[model samples]
Target: MAGIYLHIPFCKKACHYCDFHFSTSLKNKEPLLKALAQEIILRADEFKDKIVETIYFGGGTPSILAVDEIKNIIKMLRENYEVIQVPEITLEANPDDLTDDKIKELAQTEINRLSIGVQSFGEKELQMMNRAHNAQEVKQCLQTATQYFDNITIDLMYGIPGLSNQEWKQNIQQALDFGISHISSYALTVEEGTALADFIKKGKYPAVDESLAAQHFDILVELLTQSGFDHYEISNFGKPNAYSKHNTSYWLGKSYLGFGPSAHSFNGDIRSWNVANNTKYIKSLSENQLPSTQEILTIKDRYNEYIMTGLRTIWGVSLNKISKDFGLETSAFLEKQVEPFLANGTLVLKQNQLKTTQKGKFLADGIASELFWV
Candidate 1:
């Protein structure tokens, strides 16, 4: 099965720490939407025979669009692709954009999942991140959202410089109280060229505390697990039936087509990404060209990718699969490298799947990099 990702590169405002490709202008939105629809039709043949199981509308702020626009895009995809029945169609939305009327309209479409960006329920943290939604809006949006969507996931962030541990707990508690089925919590990092980075460079804001971040991550695992949520990925927790199918397919090395500006697509070997500039993207597409770059993955590149993606999830890396796909020598090399983490109790080999232990999860990226082939 394959999935599809459509990037909507427009946001109401830039977040303090965001690094994703997006524009603050709506001047080109109409053209961008048309280009995206054209892209869907143009790329339909790419994944022709594969069953489309998931379609994700992600971006700067997918919720910012009008309900009719979202419906039109979905309609276009359906006309062009063999989209599966009951596909996991998710739209990433900001809390401010979720109104009762919008939620009702969303329910009428084929979209079945809502991934709300409710970074924090604390007013102070929300303002610090320059988020448009207030604490009350998050509560209201989730309340209204649950009325229409059962497969709901909320995005959250921890490790804000001024956010306290108690506040962090409250964020998770809020998701639980709202009965949100999935939580995608991430540690706030100061990306270069972002407003937060500039503030830090000017001594106006302090750098994020790495130790505090790690402490919060530990708390996240303990609390979410106790709440009966699967700490499935390092940054994601889901109730038994709520795991994100689109993201899971990516981790499992499934092929997917990505449309619109800055979207990336992977076909198990070659990977490609569209241009980040919205104006250029629309111009190129208007000229009947897809503004994108492509790369053919070498064996080592594929192995490294597998290490990165597989190690970050509960499914982990399969020794036999690695041996069969990458050969015995490569598998032996990985086994030897993984021995230290295994002995340190940071990783465990269970049922031939090597997964990280709770204590080792915080350092997952480092461990995966260590196992990477040259």
Candidate 2:
């Protein structure tokens, strides 16, 4: 199966910690939407033989678009591609953009899921991050959104400087009170070139404490698991059968096509991404050409990716599949590399599957990196 992703590269405001490709200006919004539709039609042949089970509208901020604009994109996909009757169409939104009227309008369309970007529920934390929404808006939006969308997911951020454990616990409790099905929580990372990074460099903002982040992570895992949510991935918690189909498909290495500026696409072997510059993306699409670069995956590259993704999810890396796909020598090398971790109780071999123990879940990425074929 395959999935489709559309990246809306426009945001109303720039957050302090964000490094994703986006423009605060909407000068190119109209032309960009037209180009996105054209890109969809131009790339239809890639997924002609496959069925699209999920369509994700990721952002800068997808909720910035009007409902009709979203509908037009869906119409184009339906006409050009073999989409399933009830595909899981998700739109990533900000709490500020999701008004009562907006929520009602979205329910009328084919979009079935909403992934709200409610980073935190603390006003001081929100202001520190320069978020467009306040704590009240988060509450208002969730109260309205939960009434309309059952398959809703909200994002939360931990590891903010000066945000105490008590405040973080309150954030988790608030989200649980909303009764949403899925939660995507992430640590506050300081990406280079972002405002947060600049602040830290200038001593305007405090540096992130990794030890505190680890404590918050442990709290999150304990709380969510106690609340009957599955810690399906390192950063995701979901109710039974409520996992994100689009993201889960991506983690499983399923083929997907991404449209718009700075979007990435993958078939089984080759991965491609569009130019990050909006003007250049528009100019190339205007000339009926796809402005993207691609890389063909080597066997080693694929194996490493499998190991990385496998260890992060509930489904660990399969030894038998590794042997079948990468040959016995590669499998043997993996076995040898994983010996230390297995002996340290970080990983265990259950039914020929190398799965991480709870002790290693927080460090899954590091463990996967150690097992990578160099």
Candidate 3:
């Protein structure tokens, strides 16, 4: 099965810590949508033979568009691609944009899932992140959203400089209070070139503390797992059978087509990304051209990718699969490299899968990098 990702690269305002491609102005919104539709038709042949199980509307802010605009794009995708009869169509939305009318309108569409961007419910944290919504909006949106959709997920962030562990726990509890089925929580990382980075450089914002973030992460995992949510992926928690089908397909190395500016696509061997500039993306597609760059994955590249994604997931890395796919030499190298982690109780070999222990879950990325095939 395959998936489709459409990037909506327009936002009302820039978040202090955001580094994703997006425009603050809506000047090119019309042209961008047209280009996006054109892109769907342009790339239809690639996935003609594959059944599209998911269509994700990810973004700078997908909710920035009107309901009709989103519907038009979905209609275009259906006309061009062999989308399944009941695909898991998800739209990433901001809390402020999800008003009662908007939520009801979305419920009437083919979109079945809603990934709300409710990073934090704290007022100070909201202002610090330059989010448009306040705490009240979060509660209002979820109250209304839960009424309309069942397969809902909300994005939460921990590790804000002044956000204490207690506050972080409260944030998770607030989400649980709403009966959210899936949650994607992340630690706040200050990316270079973002406003948050500049603020820290000038002492305008406090630096992110690694120890505090780790503490918050521990709290997150313990609370969510106890609340009956599976920590299926390092950054994601889902109730049983409620895992994100689109993102799961991605981690499992399934083929997916991404349309619009700054989106990426993968088809097993080669990975490609569209240009980040909206104008350039639209102009290229106006001429019936795809503005993207691609790379052919080397055996080492594939193996390293498998290691990175595998270690972060509940499924873990399969030793037998690695042996069959990457040969005995690479498999042996991996086994030797992982011995240290296994000996330290950071990883365990269960059912031939190299799974992370609770102690090693937070450090999964670092451990995976050390075991990368050079």
Pick by lDDT: which candidate is best? Answer: 2
Write down the TM-score of every candidate.
0.98, 0.99, 0.99
For each candidate, what is the lDDT?
0.92, 0.95, 0.95
Error of 1 at 322 (Å): 0.8
Q: What lDDT would candidate 1 get against the real structure?
A: 0.92
Tens digit of lDDT per residue, candidate 3, span 1-374? 99999999999989999999999999999999989988988888898799999999999999989999999998898899888899999999999999999999999999899999999989999999999899999999999999999999999998788898889989999999999999999999999999999999999888999999899999999999999999999999999989999999999999999998999999999999999999999999999999999999999999999999999999999999999999999999999999999999989999899999999999999999999998
lDDT of 2 by residue, 1-374 (tens): 89999999999899999999999999999999988988998998999898999999998999999999999999999999999999999999999999999999999999999999999999999999999999999999999999999999999999999999999999999999999889999999999999999999999999999999999999999999999999999999999989999999988999999999999999989999999999999999999999899999999999999999999999889999999999999999999999999999999999999998988998899999999999
Q: In candidate 2, list every pair of residues with a backbone clash.
A: none
Query: How far does residue 166 in candidate 2 sit from its true spot (Å)?
Result: 1.3
Give the Å error, residue 77, model 2: 0.3
What is the descending lDDT order? 2, 3, 1
Model 2 sits at a Cα RMSD from the real structure of 0.7
The C-alpha stretches of model 1 lying farther than 4 A from their native spots are: none
lDDT for 299 in candidate 3 is 97
Q: State which candidate, 1 or 2, has the greater lDDT.
A: 2
lDDT of 3: 0.95
